[model samples]
Target: MRVKKGPLVVIGDTLLDIDVEGSAERIAPDAPVPVVDVEGEHLRPGGAGLAALLTARDGADVVLVTALADDPQGRTLRSLLNGHLEVVRMPLHGTTVCKTRVRARGQTLVRIDTGDGRALARVTDTVRAAVRRAGAVLVSDYGRGVAGTVLELLGEVRAPIVWDPHPRGSMPVRGCALVTPSELEARRLCPPPYTSPDLAARHLTKALHAQAVAVTLGSHGAAFAHAGGHHSRIPPPTLASGHDVCGAGDRFAGASALALRDGLPVEDAVAVGVGEASRFVEGGGAAAIRLQSHEMGDRPRTPMEVAELVRASGGRLIATGGCFDLLHAGHVSLLRRARALGDALIVCVNSDASAKRLKGPGRPVVGQRDRVEVLRALACVDAVMVFEEDTPAQVIERLRPHVWVKGGDYAGRELAEAESLRRIGAETVVLASVPGRSTTGLIAAVQET
Candidate 1:
């Protein structure tokens, strides 16, 4: 099934991911180590940001609460997420957060972190505001930051909280929606009679006073004990489906929170979350933002091109573009709507290099090819194209579809290809959109907690 329409929010320690990939080969004559011939370097907004993005891509109007420094990385972060999501930049007092990866043959071998391991600064007000507006919140504990004070601040907010506990804390929130712990983390949080995974979930449920308790057992999937004396085992649904496994847990936690908040049954939500997680496991996380219009055949590039195609074929053209790294719900909705406007839709995807250049040290959560393929597979999309420039002006000029579309409220400003389109006689329409349904908001929410 596709995503449902709704509102959700995520709070956690945010991050940016730097992925470096290369082919592995034998080392030099003197050395005996394997040398990697670097093929590419990529940046992705991750952690809580990715989690929120996953939930949103699954189809929800989502918001994110995260921290960013007052520096270049932070600027990059803002720009990278500018059109994707709205951000509540809780200053970190330093460079924006980052994690660097060194990979070979599509396998990640090493990761280097660069950030001060401290909770986000000036967050109480932000937390209150977000909690007041959100349907749910996930307290992401990475052990790098988000201390007791942050938890305390979160407590004051009335929203349902889902705690993705780090090993450092005692109890998370008093009555959180659920407290999710890995087997290792649960081992530290659970008491006697909670020896096995099931027993551990049961004990933790009662001990924490939360609505439920979930213990993630990696490949073994997950086990849960709800507040109503109900117990079940939930295996990760998307574990075997995606590529990198690094952010699997975070994605699961996010999806689970969203499902629960949406009022789906515990087992059902867990299973759905697991399914969503499986989808991510095959990719990294799910798409951060969805620029959906149509999944038709690839043909024209511009509104004029679309109009001309339509005129020639007795149809109309619809045009849109975005980072579209993951093609989530927002994208799907946008694409579907775009298609509704005409007979065919034209989509321009930001190239990986372009996405990296725009999103910062870590962003575009998924690879360009994967994103393109995903868009191509969607039933709503007709044609897809890739643009290397940060903006889609050149692409807009070339494609020249019948109409140009974008999500959100951008009524006053000139669109990237508007002037050119007008000069060439193409129709321009600004979609009156819902705020907080963007990739940036998804990223910010995932990164904050």
Candidate 2:
């Protein structure tokens, strides 16, 4: 939770990225194919969905409105989402936007892209509504189906729109809040290629009539052209001298969106983006999010384990910890569903002393250690650890979990940290539908006899 301001809605296409690794040996024996042995396959989220996920981690209330199919790949996509945001998955259109890459070490030599290029007709309406509701909108153009309807959406939605321009796309996005294009991609989108990032940003700004323009210069850094008719270059973080770039743009966009939505000045936002992007490429995505809630077995986990869980879960994690002194079906069902939402579930059970203090005289029929152990034994619980406080707010802040899940009769305000949660980089989901169960009610009923 890094002080986010408003909601971000993205209109774009979903993508599935695949990476191939191996050594390039001699030529093939039969024909001309290179003798490349298969090592392993890596799958990651892509396109606009990826952009949205990144924004969400930056502490924005993000919603991804896109179209994907119901096939296994689509299931994989939805599973990746894991209820992190609101998704509009289209059944008719195939979801996979596959990009096959051949990378030996630092550089990529070849890539084969695949996926359903068909744009759905009905998704536009949903996107339009979402766009109208957002504080800012970023249309990611991957030459995917996001732009067809977005073309129409530009005229209708009044929110500030940011454009992530790409090559070979028929995008008519002008008069946006900001248009961020990589130097290579900028050349493809813009007619001219200026010698410097400043010139490029200014030129694009004057050309597009947009308030701000940014051109990413890979190794050198990023430059911004502001509406005030001035330009500034934000340098990328040079860690230990050399540079190792990986998903830097995603980090930049995430931090930038959060800052802009929060009313930070252009220069300030760009600086923030640069800082976060540095952490991203430097420490990897897990550390960049700054989540404190991550558990393993019955013991509290180290920062490394938490980072691993975040990475393994693609940063999509649902976190909730409490003392269920009574232990009922209500708690069971909520925990079960929360576990299903993401790759892992981290539960923080209150310590005995804290629970006793909160519950008061003769309370917490079960000790905190025993209570945590019980939760650890459950199949749905991924990790069970102890917390000293009455609430899991401290743990939540450290973990900065994407989703804050709770089980009880609470909804909206009654649950916890209702308003402040989003700004701090987490969304709240209330689980109250379970029937005929309540710890206080059960206690009262037993005492009446």
Candidate 3:
């Protein structure tokens, strides 16, 4: 947790995204197309708007600077973004762009595109000031003229910039902190024939004069290249398939910019972006983003919800399980160390019946509820959940944490949850327990006294 006071500014083009979902049970006799029985309509901000919204969802103060026409579609886009972001409007030369996707059974049937909106050549003083004062800036160019409009300002800004390039868009400004291009877009920019994304990133970094280039490889993660000739691949936690990837690029670019703002190294920032993009697609992508869901600013979330949010933001989620009968230094130490291993820590405590069964009669000096409360009070623990089973296998399945932790006592032996973890593609680690600290030892000492 790096926290920056300056707002994250997103500069790009905004589009209205409409997802029409329903069941397609029959094929039309006239055109041989599936006839979708309309159920409901979902509207959200698209392109740069989506990037800004994602940043805001991750608890950043986001300012979106984009062009919006005076058309009905533009108004809809603004309305959708009103409470989620601070909009700095630029002039648009045409109607607002709208992409309508008709889907059935989670599969897109057809896409209908409307409008040809592009930002005007003129730049505003407000946009200039916003860019200059930004803690971090994400240029989510959708090839809609906004990037070209602010190319000069972007070059002059001292704040770190993460440029999300488009095949049809303007080239990134010189001196960008990081440039993000999808594998397909990288091929379009540097041409194929070039072997791997690593080479593509290296060539683009030098060609664009950027500090670093991250070529996003979709579900495979990203290939990172620095101007100094160092390269590495950032791998996502899981490579599960059949996920919605509509807004994954925006999630990656937006998260990278925020991480850089928090003073993370370029490599770490790209890793954060990769993790966040993976989680975003896994959570149903942009289609799941509802305006009402984002209104909760700092409200408390459940353990599973915390896990989802952490994953969605490209942050790691770690889980530890135990009876936690009595709140002691040992428990605190294990939790704190576990938290330091990832972005958020989820404590899975055994239920009262389960604890009694595991520890025998007269055990669990503290009740399960009290133990849960104590764990939740710790700053190291992000959330706490109780499991009825003796082991946390079921809980782990639901949480799907990236890392599972246990006391050092389990170091030599294989954990019972190992198979469950393998199913979810998670890893397990055992931390060294305090030599003289234990709930059982404390109980024995009290009995002797």
Candidate 4:
């Protein structure tokens, strides 16, 4: 039950991103081409669909208006967004837009795009009504024709608008709240050899007659220019190397719209947007999209799945086990340190039965599902699994993690998981816990009050 304050309306074109990952070990005999032995594939919502999904995931109630053809890809897109959003799909006259990328090992080999690029159907009364009722509006234009109709429809709405513009898309009207463009797009908007991001932002703001413009500068962060004659640069949060940056701009736009809809000032909203985008990239970006399925409810991973993931990562796996019924600063600090020791951190949470058995009756103030969600929200926790046993010995044996981490409470004391760790040939590490931060103590103080 945490709900955002109001509904956000998003208008633009939706696309399907298909990634085919395989091994390209041999070249074709007839032609000079690498023959890829297909292994796996992934499909994700892209374009404005991705922006709407990101906004909903940020806790906002979203109404997404877009066009979709009556095709297999369109059906897949609808299925993917079934429960996540209130999608108002217009009947498109052409084929659904699809971006198919073929990757070998980890590198992209080739990409093929399929679309008719036909003009979108005109906006309907329903879309206009939704826009009128929105607390805020976001236009995620991907240079697709859908944005053209959407921009025309939004001309009459007075709500704050966050336009993520494309060079070929419809230009935003005057007095809009914000416009965001990547550095490359910014340069195109204001003409080339642009001296600095600040100048580009200022120029775009004035040309679009918008209140502000935020130009995203990849790893360096974002530059902002407001109509009030103020300009500033917002740095991104530190992120690990080698993370996939796909969908980061969508996340930034969605987060900024959410903050602004909730009444945060422009500067603060831009900061929140930058932070959200950085976290999204740091947490795996496109690679993490599959994990969103588990957010609806806790789908505790089996030991086999966890092992497969660890193997796929080709990195050391670090694991820790605890009730984690109530997350606090101590838990965050410990998890952060544990993640630093390896490429991924897997948290083994105690099941409800196990928590009740260990902590006596009236324990686990938070339910198992809620606890898993809380733990999953942490950037340091890459995966979560629930163990029914009082101790995580079974899980440890199954996972055979590279390192087993414990908090300061277990320092200098014999650990119940020691035998399991030894059997699995996993090294054990004890991290110092934050002072005066214990769930038990917190519960006691609450009861006393």
Candidate 5:
């Protein structure tokens, strides 16, 4: 589905989710519980922040309105979200909300939640103005006070509203475009224990007086009931076992809101939501929601710009130069290993003219634009630049990367760029080449056939 060409305004509570993963080998001596030997930890945006992120990732401009405290976690949350979207933070008196989960081998063993759920400071004039000007509004109420303010301002907004409801939060006003709730959340609206998704959706639609209500049924897909007396079910795409389902609902809400804002009918929008959530789960769930460079709303930088960015982030800069006329597994392996050696990798590609000079006439199977695009699409390559010089000396001097990577083919030979790299005090490392994988070999094989 295509995203609309306007800003999606998300109003709700912002939360920090900390996932501590490791091995739980032996049981504790004092208790029967297993002791987890933590291997790593990841901090992610949760609640409304996640909804905003998903919307932005779906190719929509998003504005996030939420409350944050003046504590360290709040500072970290702001830092993490700063470049991702247009965030309007209303300072609250309490500490920022945080949920920490300890997991062993993908199973969450324990969770610790910290924060006050008291009312936040009232929404500022800035948030009110943003709501009025938004192309669409997504209310992700995790029972926080921000949703209350958004509900108060709904009358001022003419945009379509998609509300992901919480039992603890304020009830949605009549005429809301859609209300999405998980089956568990939907059950709270109707009779307890054994309510079907269809009945729950109908109950929600009638209770909220919304245009439609969608009840998400995890693996079974979603059930939708319209005020106009139409009902539909949108099935999920096939997902692998043990998939991360944590943020699937948020992905659905965000994508569906974008579709509805683009004027898709309720059923069609629900289909888009199902598709987005399915993709998210099938792609490894929460693991797929990490921060990406494109989410910062910045265009690809030039060499000078990249240098400045690397310096500012205080990350190691790894550089490699190649023709990359035809991308192959060998190129991918080298790039991945090079990225592992540093915080970021910059691949210097030979310009079209330089490629022709180095590889002879009609050598480069692909043009420079397509070559750069292909390289940039690889997760291992953070940035790409084109150089016209025969050697990458000019680019090397400009970047002065911390590490200069070369493939195994150059291990025993005197590298032409060694002197240039030495002048900049950059260390050079040679990585092993993958056996039987090369662009040249592929070209020769095709020619033989």
Candidate 6:
């Protein structure tokens, strides 16, 4: 079916994915295993849940049809997904699936999978109606039986269907608009000697009697074979290296469904999918999906408190430190630019004593409290911090912002707090000052007048 005006429907199983990330420095005395000093925990939706979230974030009116147990993990998933998109919950027979990845230094040390949940073989009239009215359907099957229960209904739907298959999942029904399988999954589905993705795509397309089969080849992009005797390979615009690829496949499938719904040809839709997946990986993969609240409370947050909230939600924390004595237009421009560099920006203003030490005795035309208040009034600044040290080294070390910005020309030279940034694996950014605007010059002009 080719309904093109209804909301996108994502159907399958949902999972709770947790990433416990930290630093691993030394091996334990008992065993050779590295001792990980846990830094933070990031919890987000996985499987079909993630696909629906991605589609919703792309400005689509999306609905998620999936199975969830009445458990703690299930409640958390519902809480996270409910306000974001409409969820048509189905019956689940067992516990909720929870996958925890223990990682260090941007690498996964180990993955622990739990739960034995499976969707009950019961399809409601509501699910059937949703599939019928969908502009497009994305089946993100995690092999938990949700796809199996609605397989027949999906085959009868008029809307474009994009099936993202798992190796353990059931074979796609006949006449799907697109079936996306990873290279390994395709190889597993096909017989021996069908090693090439092109061969696997063609074989699966013919055997499954589908409109097209797209075999995802990870960083190499995807290869597809259509039922109309057309086949080709689409390479990514740029290969992303050393980035997490946790949900790239789901992203590709979700985007492809949207593209097809917008009337793009299968080949072109697959190309779009490849580009989106590449960009997703380059943007920190699934970890960059910020599901947590960034709301500021009535009380002003400390640098450490702001950093903790941002990091826990998988958002970038940016910091800029200066005296901010006069709060001139140049300072405002610099603060706005720094804020644009990340998800949240926190300014570190020098304390009264610290500013006096650097700007001389008669300096700081504005007091530290008023300067902070003025800076806080700017819409670009998310939070403000006052540091007692001459340099913001101590505060920087504590907050450990992902980016540290300074307003000056110190491109090649190391900043005064460079060592502190290095210790936290943070980058330093140098922004040029606005010409003919400086606090020192302003005071001089006032004296002359």
Give all candidates' CA lDDT scores: 0.67, 0.64, 0.84, 0.80, 0.80, 0.83
Leading candidate by lDDT: 3
Q: Which regions of candidate 5 deviate over 4 angstroms?
A: 1-4, 117-121, 191-194, 292-449
| The 10-residue segment with the lowest total lDDT in model 5 | 288-297
Per model, state how many residue pairs clash: 65, 8, 1, 0, 0, 3
Error of 4 at 138 (Å): 1.2
Candidate 2 — which pairs collide?
1-424, 1-425, 291-398, 291-399, 291-400, 292-398, 292-399, 293-399
Predicted candidate 1 versus true structure: per-residue lDDT over 1-449, tens digit per residue: 33543357666667777767677877867777668787555555677776665554445667776776667666666655554455655556456568888888657777798876355446567666766776667777665454354666766656567888887643587888788888888888866445698888888888888888878876667888988999988765323344566777887888777777777766676676565555445433322122322222465544455556556654456778888865556678567546545557778888989999988877788898888888877655767788899788887777667677776556567776667788657766544342246777777767886
TM per candidate comes to: 0.63, 0.62, 0.68, 0.73, 0.68, 0.70
Which candidate, 2 or 5, would have the higher lDDT against the true structure? 5
What are the per-residue Cα lDDT tens digits for candidate 3 across 68-113?
9999999988888876669999999989999999988778889999
Q: Write the per-residue lDDT of candidate 5 for residues 1-449, one digit (tens) a residue.
A: 33434689998888998878789999999999999998667677899998887666543678999888888988888887875589988867677889998988778898899998444658679988888888889999898788886666887778889999888988887788999999888878776665589977877788789999999987778999999989878897654543578888998999899888878888898988887677566544664344434322353456566666766765567899999877876787677556645456789999999988998987788999999999988765778989998999988998889888888688679877889899999977675565456788889878888
User: Per-residue lDDT tens digits of candidate 2, residues 285-334?
Assistant: 32122111232324334533653666564545667767788887667756
TM-score of 2: 0.62
Candidate order (TM-score): 4, 6, 5, 3, 1, 2
After superposing candidate 4, which stretches have Cα over 4 Å from the reference?
1-4, 117-119, 191-193, 291-347, 351-363, 366-449
In candidate 2, stretches whose alpha carbon ends up further than 4 angstroms from where it belongs are 1-6, 21-39, 90-95, 102-110, 121-124, 238-246, 284-449
**Runs off by more than 4 Å, candidate 3:** 1-4, 239-242, 292-449
Taking the tens digit of each residue's C-alpha lDDT, what string does model 4 give over 1-449? 33434578888888998878789989999999999998667677998898887766544679998888888988899988877779987777788889988988667789899977444567788877788888898889887777787666678877789999888888886788999999989888887678989999988888989899999987788999999899999998655543568788998998888778878888788888897777666555654455222211332345456556666656467899999977876787678657645556789999999999999898898989999989887765778889999999999998889889888688679888889999989988775565457889889878888
List ranges where model 1 is wrong by over 4 Å.
1-6, 124-126, 191-194, 236-243, 284-449
The count of residue-pair clashes in candidate 3 stands at 1
